[model samples]
Target: MRDQEPAPFDAERRLSTREAAELLGVKPETVYAYVSRGQLTSRRVSGGRGSTFDAGEVEALARRNRRDGSGGSGGGNAGGELSVRTRLTLIESDRYFFRGVDAVDLATRHTYEEVAEWLWTGRMVPGITFTAPPGSVSVARRAVEALPEHTAPADLLRVATVAAATADPLRFDLSEDAVLGTARTLIPTLVAALPPRGHDRRDEGPLAHRLWPRLSMRKDPDEASLRALDAALALLVDHDLAASTLAVRVAASARAHPYAAVSAGLGVIEGPLHGAASGLAHRLLQDVLEQGDAAPVIADELRAGRRVPGLGHRLYPGEDPRARALFALLERIPRAESALLAARDIVETTARHAPLHANVDLALAVLTVSCGMAPTAGETIFAVARTAGWIAHALEEYGERPLRMRPSGLYAGPRPPQPLPE
Candidate 1:
């Protein structure tokens, strides 16, 4: 037979959650988490209280978990699933902690830079501000400017990171102090490199304020909006061992410089499954607003065999904690009221079919849509905020033994000793 696309995984066979979870060697909660994250889908039979999983999907996920025994397969393995432990962040039920502290509390009470410093060093640096060197800014901005004008926000940040790495002679230093310095400067440089909206604005105040002009053209943004942006950054600073973070750890394990480690992460996040999810949610909300009803918009999406984005998450079976926290803050913004209502409409409308809860992407969509930002703005915010997390993971990986993330591939192809093709 000619080479063909792998068939879409469907329920040729269905297994109860217990069977599926046992097949994957995980607890029932983990199976639910897998379902929530889109790693597997849960199907409920008529007159049944519990949901069953497609046997094919369950086996595929099992293969993924076993391949090199890492959470994100084919990237590299730090350890088996739940074995990539770190003191950086922990996700429990629907809540997450950073260094043993409630992340939502920290983000709401402190600035993004403060929470980031805490994540990096476990110390609170009150009123810390990251200022990129003029030389680095010049180099990064020039490199970013050279890209095609329609270049994506994440791609722009990646190019800027490479250029900034070139500007710093000590990029390969790998010492804690040097990496911390690079992190402080590199993050600001990433933000500054983007061509500013309205006019070229000088860096000032918190990192969120500096990032605002790059994502939004509105001048003199309000205090509340800036807080929302800052809170979003802090909340998104790190999620333990996400695919991009794993890519970063793998890079750092290989002794790639911090810039390069973050670059590796950026490369992984440009995919629709990760960082671009927020953008998808943004466009979804926009569609709902334009149509004046979420049912029809979501119906169109479902009819076309598309998922309603920003609806579910892997770690949170209930509403995402970040989404809950962001929604609370968003409720205070008068302008966000309409978008928030629309988001609620979307969730309620979709719940008529699937019981998925709102995720951080939906909350981010509300923020971007209400703030007069572009569809790409949510992903931009995510990229800038997540750079801190990539660096944090990089720092953690640097403390480990060198080249620890080696993958053991399971060859499914024809045996290598087979004769060469005629």
Candidate 2:
């Protein structure tokens, strides 16, 4: 696929406070307020003290504030859906790109670590290795072990994140290199700490290999399965600004440490509408495997007044590219044939019955069941893969003005009566 041409950057376009206010439908005071809040950028006039706002920056801010109802604008949407600006990933033409590089290409061609570095820094660094301190891993493992017997994988991951953060003295550094370096070590540490597959070596091979044992119950995973798993992880590395990614950015905007920002992301990831959707989809796919037909199961779901899991996405009108890419990889694996067939049938049925399409969650469900992984395996993949993304977003947020995500509130309750103390 051809890359979309990016608009050229222009810094020469300048606007006076009056011009900016006129464009934004506000007074000069509001424009200056935006500048003071770091929502817009302004520079001093040549050899003069007066400020000149960047017209391009002002316009972009105006558009966002207008949409989100934040920039001296009236109350925002009732749903509070926010419009965020990001350079991490782009979803266009039913496909997503990491910093302009097609994700599908990267998934098949690169490893998770390589794509992660590309997301964090526009350039990929060669021979980059991710390893955490033994002490940190040990602490994280103990924390994981302490969880209840029925604890979910995501819950364990949350506890482990806190434990790892407590052990890392350098986590306080918010610099790009420092935060990214922490991510490098943190990812490996998290993987190493999970319980390994019975037959696989705990300390060998790539990140995907190391993670396979922890997620799947099957023994002796093949090379093809591992490769597909790697692709899935790469594809999930980032996708525009997901809810969890936005949470990470919000935490980072407050100058939180990388670990703190990641913790914030993990909090949102456990929600049913976010990462947990994959687990729910896994259960739905299990029904498909048992019944061997998608039509009945889909019909039953609709009859029961339940929305089918992993069937549609808001961003991709026709089909999710990530789902399409991963499903192709799954079809090639001999052990995954049955599960892949089940997933395909559901996709076809959904398309035929409704205007819905398969999403990455459905693809992940097929992969999990086919590999004999735990029901929560899909969410595990999501959380681990998205750690790379969350940290990358944290890095981006750190470079911006601190606390920039804070939005003004508009009260809606009944007005108070006259003061009683008067």
Q: What's the TM-score of each model vs. the native?
A: 0.82, 0.83
lDDT per residue, candidate 1, 115-196, as tens digits?
Answer: 9999999999999999999999999999999999889998999999999999999999999999999999999999889888
Clashing pairs in 1: 37-314
- Weakest 10 consecutive residues of candidate 2 by summed lDDT: 70-79
Against the reference, the lDDT scores of all candidates come to 0.89, 0.83
Query: What's model 2's overall lDDT?
Result: 0.83
lDDT of 2 by residue, 198-221 (tens): 766475568898899888877777
**Reference-based TM-score, model 2:** 0.83
Off by over 4 Å in 2: 1-81, 197-201, 418-422
Look at candidate 2 and tell me the lDDT of residue 152: 77
